[model samples]
Target: MSKEAQFSTDKFRLDGKVAIITGGASGLGFNYTKAMLISGAKVVIASYDEKGWDETSKFAKSVNGEVKFIKIDVTAKEAPDIIVNAALSKFQKIDILVNNAGMQRRNNSVPI
Candidate 1:
């Protein structure tokens, strides 16, 4: 009897794909970046905080993942161009884009 192939995250593999993840330097965005890398996709992390890049870089290296990063506020008018250019410059083509960049400000704490 022929052996059946196993169903796993391999079914969701993104080999040879390139992705741009906004806010990928921290929070939920960071998790998305890690997952994409593990799935064989090269990732470009676009974030507002430059400091997060270092941390993301460390994790990428530990996983032997291919990653690049750019620091720019997603709210800027030129952000789209900047991010697209950055991704194209390194990976040549973009296959996936994660629009995960945003910010929030709390004016008051909840009453106990």
Candidate 2:
């Protein structure tokens, strides 16, 4: 069989799998989204940034894969539930979840 056929076997195929990726609008998260799509996984990328959200949505469309963007602040108490619901509403099931949302600010000195 051909390479594509080999990869399409049950073990390698993610045809019915659903993946939720946070911070997926750009950088490392974007790459993860693309990889999951190429592997046949439906992906939902959540982000609070509007510009990044729009750009990511456009890119996802070009790939012809099932992708969606849900505006959310990861730090919020209800954000996780909201994201989970959105993914389920779109794809019906969630097979994988990539929690890549968070921010880190630099602190030059420590105060005692």
Candidate 3:
């Protein structure tokens, strides 16, 4: 069989993996968190929105996979290191990182 045809159920599993998803409190990042949790990976969601953190974390917990929410501003230079440190502190290692946080300035002069 070809390599593409060799995929198996086990190959699709994320058991024992740890993932970090920026902007995971909402939008597409949240979707990725859900998929990772369902696939058996522990996820650390980094976002600036505290409001969505509670709700999103609740859903992730209901899936029976470990999840942690850390408030972060991804625009900061230290943000990446902070995220990695947090994830490492919790899960000891990071196997996946989804850099999904982004900002767009409005009216050309609006602050990001």
Candidate 4:
């Protein structure tokens, strides 16, 4: 039996890659957004929180990476197209996708 090891330095580079993230205004989504930016990836965040959007955009600008926020409800039927188009219009190509938008509601006991 023979063992072989291979490594490529280019695998870690994200230069010229575009990423679209949903629910990226805060929480885990926000963290992922920052990490991607630090790795040299252009990011577009789609969220429903206006204030968070503004703040995240400002923060992203400070980091010197291309970032954009688009207010959208991911539940909407047309949301996918809108997001895809936005990313394409801005960066011309999308190399990654981060679908992180979701919500949960408390459940009440049903009347029997």
lDDT of 4 by residue, 7-92 (tens): 23255667778999998878888877877776778999988876577667776787678897888898789999999998899889
In candidate 2, residue 78 scores what lDDT? 99
Instruction: Please identify which of the two predictions, 1 or 4, would achieve the higher TM-score against the true structure.
Output: 1
Q: Which ranking of candidates, highest lDDT first?
A: 1, 3, 4, 2
31-105 in candidate 2: lDDT tens per residue? Answer: 777777767788888888755766666766775678888988977899989999999899888999898877876
Per-residue CA lDDT of candidate 3, range 1-112, in tens? Answer: 6642232435578999999998887878877877888789999988887767776778777978789888989888998899899999999999998989878876576478
Error of 4 at 28 (Å): 0.4
* Candidate 4 similarity to native, TM-score: 0.78
Misplaced by over 4 Å in model 3 are 1-11, 107-112
| TM-scores for every candidate against the unseen true structure | 0.81, 0.76, 0.81, 0.78
Weakest 10 consecutive residues of candidate 3 by summed lDDT: 2-11
Whichever of 2 and 4 has more TM-score, that candidate is: 4
Task: Summarize candidate 1's per-residue lDDT along 1-112 as a digit string, tens digits.
Answer: 3472233556798889999999987888988887887788899988878867887888788867889888788888999999999899999999999999876667775489
As a whole number from 0 to 100, the lDDT of residue 108 in candidate 3 is 75
Pairs in clash, predicted candidate 2: none
lDDT of each: 0.85, 0.79, 0.83, 0.81
